[model samples]
Target chain A: MNYRIWEGKSGDSLNSENQKCTSRCGMTSSRPGMARRSFLRGTAAGIGGMAAMAAALSPLRELEAGAFNSVEEMLQKHYKEMTPDDMERALARIRRQVEQRYHVRPEIRDIKPVEGVEFAYALNLSRCIGCRKCVHACVAENNQSREPEIQYIRVLEMPRGTLNIEQGNHHYDRPTVPDDKHFYLPVQCHQCANPPCVKVCPVEATWKEPDGIVVVDYDWCIGCRYCEAACPYWARRFNFATPKIPKGALNPNMAYLSNRPRPRGVMEKCHFCLHRTRQGLMPACEEVCPTGARKFGNVLDPRSPVSEILRTKRVFVLKEDAGTLPRFFYYFDERYPRNTGGEAPTWTGPEEFPHG
Target chain B: MGMILAGLSAIMPNLDSSRQNEFDGAQPGLEELAHPHAEPVDPHIPGGALWAMVGFAALAFYFVSQPALPEMPLAATPVVQASEIAPGKRRDPIKEPPRIRVGAFTYGCNECHSLFLSAPERQGPLAQHTHIKLDHGLNARCFNCHDRFDREKLVLRDGSLIGYDQVPTLCSQCHGTTFRDWERGMHGKDLGSWDLSSPRHVRLECHECHDPHAPAYPPIVPLPAPNTMRMGTPVHLAHEHKPEAGNPLAPWWMHVAGGDGAAHGPGDAHEQTTHHTDGKTESAPSTHKEGGGQ
Candidate 1:
């Protein structure tokens, strides 16, 4: 296995077996007794300093020098054991890689682990038009695995001319639209004000903050999926296997709010596009909306657009009797046209019945 | 002569006083008193009996303006439980019993009706028609005849009533059209369902179905559809029965027949009694020992 002795020797003098062995382990057969002092000295110094010098001068593992450094770093910290400093360094390195690869100077924001904010979300079902844009956008933004394709958002195609939530299906195929007999309702996490997910978390790894945002510390999570079940809205999802994202396609503009490169066996959900919203910008869905249905603003600010809509418009929260006090509100229209594809008959009456 | 002069002076002053009394005592002209009944009297009487009567009348009028105690009943009925009810028992169909006289409705029809005085059953004469011709004899009362209603003003405990412009929710108690619609979220008004440009929706009345007195599910459809009540079925409950993911304890109940794990069951949990690969019928677990827990 020792190929250091042959490292300086002519290639013709060395056997192919020894060459292969040297290449595999990057170890060379040399006078170990003579190099013992030098190796110890190198070890006393940091590994990176040695790596930098090795990359330039060492003939051994020149092609693998970069890969080895990264692999070594990856093995150093099990995600759970990583410290805040380690995360920052890891994020910085990722940033460099993404900038080099994609030519995208991503606005990477290290979301401060808010001390007391619980993050949640609510979809205005009355506003959704069964557009699959949110679904596709989530797939592209989250960098989901191929095969049985995955995305966080599932724009359910609800029955038209009816507001029956039961008739909606998320397992819709291509050409996804509201069923002719059903009205389109896009559903996502209700992000309940009282999150059962936080209550059921075995380790206080996931918690709600003062800002009403619920978050999970990925490193602290044991992947029990207890939070997922405790959630009535089915907002939480668990990563059963290691996530695969093509390095080139990875979104470098990651925020703790919107998209953070998640580890395996952890739970995740919509952060209300926090990465964008916290920066005083609209969410990706609102930015990309075709119907101008989605509205996002602070409910506390009375003058804000969301608050104004709530004040003047006949807005109602879903399942208010449940006492969840959801922030998302909906405005019903009376003159909405019926999509008559399904068997459910549209009953036309006085101009008072609201279209859902 | 001196005595006569002193008497004349005293008489002159007495004469002026007498003249003033005569003028005041004389019957007042029409210009002084507008009417003879407007008799002059002492102005210092405190609240007299007449004043007390007027104050009492004013107080009574204010009290009369507001209706006596809320006429609508506030008690909630014990939730009707379906799970405990036996399947085949033909319970009486929920209907408001007929009220012929003062105490005809004894079976708590007012539990749902709330307001007692103008029960929907007393609107029309039931003596002339049969139960079949009268649509189960439901159209007998005041609420039965009156259709639209408003919840803000309810029928009073006394005979006095207010006109309800919007539909009364009385129909919802029996018809369940609006209740079913509400469960599916079709009946009620909300902004989220409508376009903002034209934003007006209907306010449905409960009397839209039941004759308020009879309060029956309108026999509008030919037959009620069969109930399909499967738990965890996609229609009723989708993706809800999934076992906790990656739980090792899950594998115990799902082990294959004869302890062979290869021929697995579907959906991450299996119920297999025989191994098909080798056509071996696995010996059943002793029903007596395993089935009954000590």
Candidate 2:
């Protein structure tokens, strides 16, 4: 009770005694009393530090309040670890967020992989006309950013004599395509069985689904961009700024792992339109290809079109040297380009197949 | 060399006499290094000379960094008008085949063709059917596909009459591989769903994508090329490069080789093959014409 008076009387003596005691007890400070001037200086320095911190963080005040993640979202479990209840809560929160931003109640769902189905895609090289309808149609269906322009598919116009992709042109703006001297090669995420992107993910934000789709949980991503570097096909795209999609162009059919609106700084790629595929519908790209060049089906089903192609045609995957084991395949039918006169007499008439 | 050194020594009083003596003695080819008639180096450069040089360099850099004065915009190359390019048409599933109009009434083919017994062979361009340009290569004769007896039906190679919906059966006579591929849902467009369990899947018929008369897919204008990250210029702005720069759109080999001659021009082969195939088809009796020609 009288320690202040006693400490004043024995300040210099107690200072040395307390320093020894505090050093033995592992306490930091051994000062018996604070000087009026030192206390004022310390108070001023502490206030200045607080002011500096406030000024440093002032830019955050301009951030869109709606874009900020909720406490629940920040603390959400990884995609693989989430229980059904956790997923439902997440979906509900997403619905609220989407409605608030877009003024449209989206039919967002957590679509899961179907059992006993492994999706594979095949493209017929002979028929592809290099018309980039699939690219635009995918953008419309996927709700990708239009201003900064994120395209999942890149249709390369490859020269007839060589198959090197580096030699192909991505900026071909010919009025009409198939250009007579070139063939089209549209590339997207191959949904590799041995996905490098998934392997290189610092957080387990991205992983291969049971059905062979590589998906990213946007909420859990730390935006390190390691997976983008790992992809050989240049498939993954990073949102450098807040994605700006036209309000009317927003596709309301959202899926948690596939076509949902991605926040800025997450990695995204083609997920084989898992939102539609899981529900027994064709991917937007496959459905929109005017030439019918794109083919997608369950490879496990022998009767599927993709299975038939793999069984009959000499199909090859891109970047086979990378050992990606891509589910996407490209094949050529033994026929000349349509309307071009070099039609191979493989199965034209009785002259070729006399038994017929 | 002696005159230049004397001039340099007069201008640069700070020049050491020992260094001048060493230069004179050590270098025997000093006359070659000094241009015989050139002026000596001026040690009394202007006080503002360094600033002048710096200013000149800054000016040069500014000009270099500036985008070349937007060249007098040339009259733009006349690209195929966007309107001229064909927008590819998809067949409506419920739409019916063509019917002739006769005085405000649409009549079926049988209604007119059955009224007259026309010549078996085409005599000339018919005045009545001027619109039908028979350009199906060697299969140009009307009787080749249309049933002469039953004007409403198409005649297969076996002379069996088939409805318009059975065009694939007739086409399969020549395009066997395509027909088989179409049947397996590999060649032509399949709509709705990929799952066989879904009833919404529909396979387009042969005539759905191709005109039976032409049987060739027409060239169509492609959608706009991507301009992702604003890295690419618009198609109209693509004319910035000179034509002599080789085509920016051309294959990398063309740029390296500097001409189209480096590669086999497909157009040449295409023309030759067209002539050869047409000749072989016209002279059907000559089974070995293609082999003999080769």
Give each prediction's DockQ, rounded to 2 decimals.
0.00, 0.12
Chain B TM-score in each of the candidates: 0.20, 0.48
Q: Report how far residue B88 has shifted in candidate 1, in Å.
A: 61
Q: What are the per-residue Cα lDDT tens digits for candidate 2 across A276-317? A: 999999998888888889999999999889998999889998
Badly placed stretches (over 4 Å) of model 1 are A1-90, A93-107, A112-127, A146-148, A160-164, A174-179, A316-323, A337-356, B1-294
Give each model's clash number. 49, 0
Which structure among the candidates has the greatest lDDT?
A: 2
lDDT of each: 0.42, 0.68
Task: Give the alpha carbon lDDT tens digit for every residue of A201-313 in model 1.
Answer: 88777775455656666546779999877765556667644455554656666764347555556787766666655545445554444333556555555434455456555
Cα deviation of B245, candidate 2, in Å: 17
> What C-alpha lDDT, on a 0 to 100 scale, does residue A308 get in candidate 2?
88
Top-TM-score candidate index: 2
Lowest summed lDDT across 10 adjacent residues in model 1 chain B is found at B285-294
Docking class of 2: incorrect
In DockQ terms, which candidate is top? Answer: 2
